[model samples]
Target: MGALGKENKDLTGVAIGISVLINVIGTFFFPRLLMVSGKEYGPAIIYGDYKNIWVYILSPILGAVSARILYKFLEVTKPAKPEPWHCNICNHNHLPFF
Candidate 1:
């Protein structure tokens, strides 16, 4: 999107936030909705067990949000002039091959 001149940082952040929310909801809620009530299956099925369900639900969201925060911090801290060869004092003869 940035290469195509459609760079909207706010939109990107919103999309990431929404996707994380949907993933958490689906992970914790979808399986229970699929199970049939009062029917005998091969074994008992459990969904959203209290022991670790919150961890499963929140970890992805926290990780993604933290990553975005880190990215934003790095973006703001990044130097405006990225090329080292632009400085005349540097001894480098030519730009390093990317």
Candidate 2:
């Protein structure tokens, strides 16, 4: 016998848990891709709140500065650039998905 029954999880329960987790993250934490995220965060412009329009100008500058500061402070690792891809089956050296 095992020490506990907690290790076993049914497929449906695991799927549901993952679905809830993804939805929660997407709702609260995850920002969508570039243009979509910009549009989603554009309530000030969308709602005619021109008073707060400075957000469009300031956010990029502030975000860049904060990112640089965090990069220097945390010593974040950057991924290496991928080398030019050469497909074996296609017998071509062209870019992937192009």
Candidate 3:
């Protein structure tokens, strides 16, 4: 249902933005170095390529888009509403959710 109207876009956009922001913030918490076998060590930031930044920036957007497409295809927004006593929607049917 488009009952949300204009609020839908605003809410969804902010949600996507917030998720991406959290991912970016988490990137900073990544260990700068990796300890191997508790003896040897190496750089944790793999490849050390600035271009890899795009992967971090774009992955959330891509994932969100894919999830939206999947949800629409699965008709999650317009689910089959059964009687309260008979409702039994199983998560197993929706494999790999997000």
Candidate 4:
């Protein structure tokens, strides 16, 4: 197994944490995407009050699970090294995301 460096570990952890927060906030926003016509489409689905609770609850659970799964992927992928670059626009070494 490839060992994660401190920066990667910290970055991954922060990403996971942010995902958790987004999922929590999304509980309110996502159900809004549901549309009702006695049919589910077109962004007008009315969430029953109980469904609201269900959504807020399940979303975070799923988010945490997804984060865990993503972490597993992170563990498997090799960390990329920053490439050295010289920029005429500015004098400094820089790396761009590939």
Winning candidate number (TM-score): 4
Pairs of residues clashing in candidate 3: none
Regions of model 1 farther than 4 Å from truth: 1-48, 76-98
RMSD of each: 12.3, 18.0, 16.4, 14.5
Candidate 2 residue pairs that clash: none
List where candidate 4 sits over 4 angstroms from the true fold.
1-7, 13-49, 76-98
lDDT of every model, 2 decimals: 0.52, 0.55, 0.50, 0.59
Between prediction 3 and prediction 4, which has the larger lDDT? 4
- My TM-score estimates for the predictions, one after another, are 0.31, 0.30, 0.30, 0.37
Model 1 per-residue lDDT tens digits across residues 1-98 = 03312344545677678766766687586654222223322223354335534444565578679867865654433246445455467655555456
What's the distance in Å from true for residue 89, model 2?
54
**Per-residue alpha-carbon lDDT of model 4 for 1-98, expressed as tens digits?**
35776646668767857866765686587655322223332223444334334554465578669867987776645567888898778898778756
What is the per-residue lDDT of model 2 for residues 1-98, given as tens digits with 9 covering 90 to 100? 23213323334376457646755676565343232236635675678766745655675688669756854564434456556788798777865453
Off by over 4 Å in 3: 1-49, 76-98
